[model samples]
Target chain A: MTNVLVLFGAVIFPFVVGYILISRVPQLLHTPLMSGANAISGITIIGAMLIAGREGGNFGYLLGMIAVVFATINVVGGFLVTDRMLQMFKKKGNKNPQE
Target chain B: MEISLSAIGFAHLLAAGLFVLGLRFLSSPTTARRGNMLAAIAMLIAIVATFLDRQIVDFTSILLAIAIGTIIGAFSARLVKMTSMPQMVAIFNGFGGGASALVALAEFQRLSVQAQLPLPVTVTTLLSVLIGAVTFSGSMVAFGKLQGLMHGAPITSRLQKWLNIFLLLVVLVLMFLIIGSAPSHALFVILTVVALIFGVALVIPVGGADMPVVISLLNSFSGLAACATGFVVGNNILMFAGALVGAAGLILTQIMCKAMNRSLARIFIPRQAIQAEKALHDASGGVSESSAAKSDNKPQIDPLAAAVQTLSAAKSVIFVPGYGMALAQAQFKVVELANLLEKKGATVNFAVHPIAGRMPGHMHVLLAEAEVDYDKLREMDSINPEFKNTDAVIVVGACDVINPSATEVENTPISGMPILAARDAKSIIVCNYDDKPGYSGVENPIYQDAKTICLWGDAKDTISQLITSFSG
Candidate 1:
């Protein structure tokens, strides 16, 4: 019963809330917004970590280790790249002309 | 290791709240960086909490994997150019999906070997692996097209639609079979392989012009796959984050589809069919071929001298940029030209189409990277009316967005699509490599307009030449 409820909440609730949240965003920030969301999807890192830390033998450990590597890349890379892109949107007075 | 499950759950709830706040802030530009920081912090909290969970039995390997991943991630994110952001995002999406699929596969294998597989766990595991595999392979194809490693044009045949449908059915049947029986590792493996192929098939028929939509859709798939992984692992924070990403990505995809004046259903139809139909219409003389043929004889001008003269005389000019500007790395030159024009007492502004570059807000990001003033960049609706009163419009490496056929011609590929009214300006100067048709395979008649001057060369070369001439 709990599983069904959790699955329902996971699938449907976020869709409703996320639609409302994203609708307010202007078109100019859409790319950064997508990148930011891409970063958030890296939440799979949690599951990957759990698997890696488990004593699931050699093959399982190998898969978990790779998963960890990939998820971390998504989290670290996604956030930093998004920040780099957003940094470019500074106001005229605050602009860094060097880049 | 001291934190209890409930405590971890509470932390996840708080993290989820921060993510929502982060997205809210990201809706606007000024606070977007702070929003990104907030989300990053939230991710940090989630990771740290997971590491502290009692279920963890090994740390050395996990930490080592994280170290390796961090080095690659930070380096690529820091080093990649702003113009190639879409390809970078695609690659990242692929990695995320691949990770989710691998986690699910590992968990399923462990459970099946232990004879402890439950129905719900089994279902979610199958789903995560399938969606994740597809997202992984599909995003690779998207990255290939964007990076020019593969042709940007859609590769499809008449049998593509049927083949995709058949493959989808096979995967579905295999999924049910796995779910119905004891965990058959071989069946799961086959399902993953089929799903991966299906992902490649799904993206191959999509043309480069529609890459933004493809990227957005793939982004959503990666999120949903993560959500399924969360279910398999029984992690609340992972589930919430996945849902958030899935929802946001879908909305973005819809917005991109709307901006292109294309229905989501129409976008999935192979581009070859659309092109073939248009070809048949053209052959039957449905639209006048005279203008297309006459384009070969259109007068070409000395772009540098003509652009300098035009800038010198014009009191107000609007610059329209497209994917070609990004392709040629000409955004900095465009910014320089705009600065020079502003100094000459001619007001300069950028007219940005919503779908102008490879992705949503692509031109805005490119110009922003070039340090173009935010106020000087205007959206399609706001700038369309101003074009008629504008003295000169300089088109930089753009085609379809400024194509007059979008507004003038009927029953064509780009008809009724919103475009900049560059044709209404006093004079139009186009800087591109050649007078070839744009991505839609439709010949642009604007190049043949008497007042229009074609400057055939790379955008960077031509724009810099104009800047030099203006300085002289």
Candidate 2:
């Protein structure tokens, strides 16, 4: 049953990712599109998550921990980076005082 | 250790849902920010789940690593300027490629050392290595050029095209034999390096004029590589996502090519006589445009007087802005002007061309930032009809895109490209700092039109004066 669950995860995860990439990505950007995508791809922590939860060797668990930290950095780091870039545009947006 | 696919699957699904919605929202400048936010949210969810799921042996090291990366990423992002966003994007893209490449190469080393890799594994592994290496190097060259660390002109010389063909042959031969039977890892490494150089050569020669399109095309290549990597790893999510990106990027590349009136092959053509011929034509025609300015006879109207007339003269006005508009930081004032015009019972519309400004829908984003109504912003196809009904088309700080040269000039970079035909309007008033032609160095004859008028100055100041001229 757990194997079935794992298989289901593998099948469904791709569909979800596909939905995001196909129907959603093309709407607003192209130039800076890859940066956002790259930032998102740092989600390898999920792989680490599986490795971590599994009853693995001590070294395997250590490897999983390292991977999770890297993944977390990517996520939080990506958002902060994006916000910072957005700020520069905001500052230069327009000359209107009301705005 | 046993991996539970079900829990991870549900998490991936939710994350992917967010990713899709984020992408959809990004399509319109109106929703671009929201889309970015949604995507960010999805990333957050993905990261958090992955983090929590990991087995915690010693939490201190994990927390420290997270802390260090967060500080660095946040700091770097904050420090980067909007003007340099393109370069930053390239760098980030290179990182993804490099990471994937390193992963594939390391895995190959791991498997090779074990002295036995199945046929399927070997093939998938090599494909991943090849794609990743190419993407990594190509993206770095792109970043270097965009960052001004390298030249923007196409770096071409005689027989460079033939050289590329030879390189491709070597790369293919190397790929075929190595995958069939494992070779010395050192030889394979060298082969990968050579292919990486070829990737750099392929992109470095492309001119800055075609940058937006090149960026899209290279992006598609990267996505395709990612898909191959996913196959190697048996990661369905990576494959699906990569396919989506590849398809979208390819479509964008096509649209960009069409917009420039250039073929895909033209982008890769090296040291060809066709380009030389085009340059010759441009230089010959340029001499006449500078000399043709009608001297001293025509009456130049003051902006205030023009504004008063503009307010009273027409029922409908279409404002067409370009890269100049963005540079001027005048969108807010333009918004104000639009509002005033609307209040005075004049219908106002924004005409946006597909390839206008520096990127696709460039002016649209600037205007949306000014809080302009989304409905009022119209694409080229939709607004052409409105131009017929329009009494005035006030073109602001724009060039190239609106230049009649596209329709009239032959062999020019933008020849045969569609434009707004703003010159056809009953009254066309262009507010710009320069009477010169745009990007391709070709001259625009629109300034010579009988009804055409040029109000020259810095765009923001001129538009600000127009706002004052209108309010008073």
Candidate 3:
């Protein structure tokens, strides 16, 4: 139980601190912040695979399976999304059209 | 009991730490890539640690599930195009929300089958399940709209608002039924379906411009539902991370909403449903037809030599970027030009508008990706005072947001819209394609200003040229 508490510590501490810092900054950086944070969500899939495999109750395994699937799609598709979004500019050769 | 649950917990801790570093890096577009890579490494290590755990006796299902998902994930990543990225994000996010909802629902079923459910546990689980399902479905609908599988800005009338209000009322009723009496299987499914429909109803009427905020808000709801589920399951780490995501996502959503000068409640109001009614009463007026047509002409520039002379003599330079920069993908070249100018020790700070790009803080991320120093980026209010102090202001790929005329033009569609006043700067250089209208389709009178020089071209090409001219 204490170990669980400590495990809780790792996840909770950073989130709290991060939430505070980001909240204080100007709101304008939110999109970039979100895009950057999305990469970590991809990492979450990797985490899901390990925990789900180890905690193999039939129920846990199934739930884990779904989590792994969704998180993976999030990660890979997310990166692709970010990359594609960046490509919109290179697709067109212009300085700043429409002043 | 769970194979040194403490040690593995530490590993998760380390992974979460990596997530923090990654998130921190994400805060600035400049360090976003490094942040992403670091988080990926952390995630890989987390997988290895989890794999090493002795909790699971059988690995067969694990291997199969991973293999299938990996293949599917990899293929989708390869196939999704840049234009479709927003829709992909919406779809993937919906899945994340849906998975959490499913987990909660399954847990409830298991408890129900045993005929042994704790009172508090059942309530939280039901709450999570319904919210999660709704978020997932709603996100999918949003994706459809953004992808143009549905129309971009399908403005209906006041019925949209009434429906949204009615849905909220229904959600409250469902909550009461779930909490007061243990819901039967049919009721549970109905509750889930209604919530999902409510999610769709919530997003259906919003204009295309509001997608960024809508996406962020749905992300928050998904996180909140996950946190609620974590609580029901007695998983502390899951609860913590879920809460973190929920809170941060909500805050981000609020900021995004504010950037658009909108309130979260207003997003629910569905004014578009009343569009026809308002049109009949108000004679169907908003955008001026004449001004929209005025933006089509090719922009003319002042002499290059004279413009260069003006900039060379200026003491301070603040470059204001809008969606145009993102559309142009000119952050790298913009940074290069800034660096070139900074070599001469001209104080160059990026004046970022709150709603400058397609999303909130869009330009910051783009600039950060180019490795611009963090200190150089200033928000609208921060840079506003300095615009008076600055010698030259460069308006890049910006639209009416920079137009000085909008501040006073009450009759104009964008009248009273706050913008960076390049017209206010001593010598202003407007670097955009031409007089072509922006996304909102309005003309900028700032272009016709005596001091404003319009540098007409695509931003990337033009900035590169500007850099070359400087380098030579």
TM-score, one value per model: 0.94, 0.77, 0.74
| DockQ result, candidate 2 | 0.21
Candidate that beats the other on TM-score, 1 or 3, i.e. the better one: 1
What residue pairs clash in candidate 1, if any at all?
Answer: none
Chain A vs. true chain A, TM-score per candidate? 0.82, 0.55, 0.54
| Residue A86, candidate 3: alpha-carbon lDDT | 35
TM-score ranking from best to worst?
A: 1, 2, 3
The recovered share of true contacts, given per candidate in order, is 0.81, 0.21, 0.32
The digit string of per-residue lDDT tens for model 3 on B1-472 reads: 5557787778867766676676566554455556656655665666666665665455776667667766776687678643344566667677667766766765665556644456777777887777788878888888888767887664556587778778878878877776666546666777888888988887887666567788777766766676666666554444554555666777788777665566677655534434423332232233334533434443443345546766778778989887677667787888887877787879999888776764555666567556666667787777787788788888788876776545654434344556765666787787787666554445565665667666788988877777776767
Which candidate, 1 or 2, has the higher DockQ? 1
Error of 3 at A83 (Å): 11
The count of residue-pair clashes in candidate 3 stands at 25
Q: List runs of model 2 lying over 4 Å from the truth.
A: A1-99, B1-5, B13-18, B21-38, B48-69, B76-84, B270-287, B296-314, B327-345, B465-472
TM-score (C-alpha) between model 2 and the true structure = 0.77
Per-residue lDDT over B83-159 for candidate 2, one digit per residue giving the tens place of the 0 to 100 score: 45555555555544554454455446545665556776677667756776776688788878876789976787766
Q: Highest TM-score among the candidates is held by which one?
A: 1
Go through the candidates in order and give each one's DockQ. 0.78, 0.21, 0.25
Q: Candidate 3, residue B382: CA error in Å?
A: 3.6
The model with the greatest DockQ is: 1
